[model samples]
Target: MGTKKYRRDTLIEAGLLFSLFYLPGYLFLAGIPDPRSFNSLLYNLQIWILLVPQIFMVIYLMHRDDLLDFQSFGLVRPGAKDIPFILLAAAGTAAVVMAVQVTIMLVAGEVLPEEPLWKLTKYSMIAPVFISSLLTGYSEELFFRSYLYTRLEVLDTEKWSRLIFVNILFAAGHLYEGVPGGFNAFILGCYFSFLFTRKKNIHIPAILHGLYNFSALLLTLFL
Candidate 1:
């Protein structure tokens, strides 16, 4: 009975991770995180409310169940040798931004951001940008590449097959981004998966993922 309960709980937690990734979009679709009201503190607070709780739940459950740890979760501190790889990831992210820009131009012609791109670096947005980037970087990497990756590794499936399957879900989570964005995310997902496995340290991927995302937001919004 305990075994059955454990399996059931695991299944539910898996579903939660997928849901958490996609839930923030509902706010925009439902017009709850209304862009029109973004200047108001209340509107801004709504954004945080929508984003935070589910993520915290994932962390709490993972910790409580003893399913996560610094190493298993890819929270290891990097060795000096890892510096170049991390830096390379940052540089590669810039290239990815350029590629995505070209792809967006070709596919969508002009995919306007919900928020003003020009205002991304504004003083008011500094806090939001930092908070959102930090949350996205830390949470998504921990949930997807770290937790999901570790669980999937235990499956009898072939290695590449498992990685590809996970990448598809990761890309699909960003489906609201349109075809180009999804494609970009798919490629990025695959790359990060490869990095995570090869390095056996999620810190590099986390750093790379965070910087990639933060830069992608800026370049996508501005350039």
Candidate 2:
């Protein structure tokens, strides 16, 4: 296929993948007594159930993209130089997120409440959270950066337009989190997209993404 045709096909595939992951969550949230309420176990359970399908869809999409090739996914040893930078970026991002969360709580003059906080720190939950972060980091990078951005680059005919389109979709995916979260995620997505385009690797962004989520979980627990 021509590059343009390939990219258009890839974008359609990505849209389908995103819809599979998000539609059910939207439906579940629709039924909630208070969509934003953190008090209901049933609501939480529904969210968790929605995540299962999302994860599976991500895996299938990544596999289809050939981005899940063991070496590409960081299953092999990375160069020594790449390792240190990746570690530093991940750690730095996590620290910044923690700082932001603390600032928010202080400004709000209230805590995150016990139940949701406990969900983050509980020993049994730690393993699952870590695994989920790792998987999600890999999956999102594969879909958004490797597949979607690469395809956009092929189709847009102009570099800046490709960047803008990719960032918009990246931001849109985070809309469920509210405006601030979507904006922040979009800004972060731009950074990651730039990194991927420059470095020609997904490992760094995956590490950063994982660390960002892990840091958010830590704030949920300890702050």
Candidate 3:
């Protein structure tokens, strides 16, 4: 009876997270006429506003459930032993993202346009880039890998279904980057999810995520 109740509760929590958190953002992006043309600063600010509340909500929910510990979220303090793995994952992810863009450019026979995020590099706008990247990185890892994934596990969700559900939403969120970007995100999601499942640690992927976004913004400064 307790087992059944736990399963039911986990299912409810998973449903709520998907509906309240992921679906809204996906729908918002889908509803946008031209997200590319949207004001970068405004977009950055809007994201920060959205993410702050969402992060707090995650914290609140986890605390309420007494699942607020770092391990519960698949997070841990990085040690020297973990540095190489994190670096390798970050590099691999970066390579894959670049490879996709390069392949698309070569096939299209034209240079790809600048990323919308690159617009945030102006000194005055720079802070948002770092903050948003950091927030997005940890928040996404927390939500997808630690929270939703664990909830689904408790509910005995099918392995394939869990993978597809978590990754599709993640990839969908990157659709503003266009098809190539979405595809790239899906590939990275698989890697991060697998890593989290294997190591029970979210910091590697989270740090890599932030670094990837930070590097993108930093590129704008150099170029």
The lDDT leader among the candidates is 3
lDDT string for model 3 (1-223, tens) is 1277666776787678778878877777554244232236687788789888887777667666633465766656678888888877777787777777777778765435554433433666667677778888888887887788766765667987998888887899878666766777887888788878877887787777777777776766767
Error of 1 at 120 (Å): 2.2
Off by over 4 Å in 3: 31-46, 66-72, 102-111, 114-118
What pairs collide in candidate 2? none
| Each model's lDDT | 0.65, 0.61, 0.73
Model 3 deviation from native, Cα RMSD in Å: 3.5
Give candidate 1's error at residue 171 in angstroms.
1.6
Assess the local accuracy of residue 55 in candidate 2 as a C-alpha lDDT between 0 and 100. Answer: 53
Q: Name the lDDT value of residue 96 in candidate 3.
A: 76
Q: Order of candidates by lDDT, top first?
A: 3, 1, 2
- Which runs of model 2 end up more than 4 angstroms from their true locations? 1-8, 23-77, 91-119
Count residue pairs with overlapping backbones in model 2: 0
TM-score to true structure, per model: 0.71, 0.66, 0.79
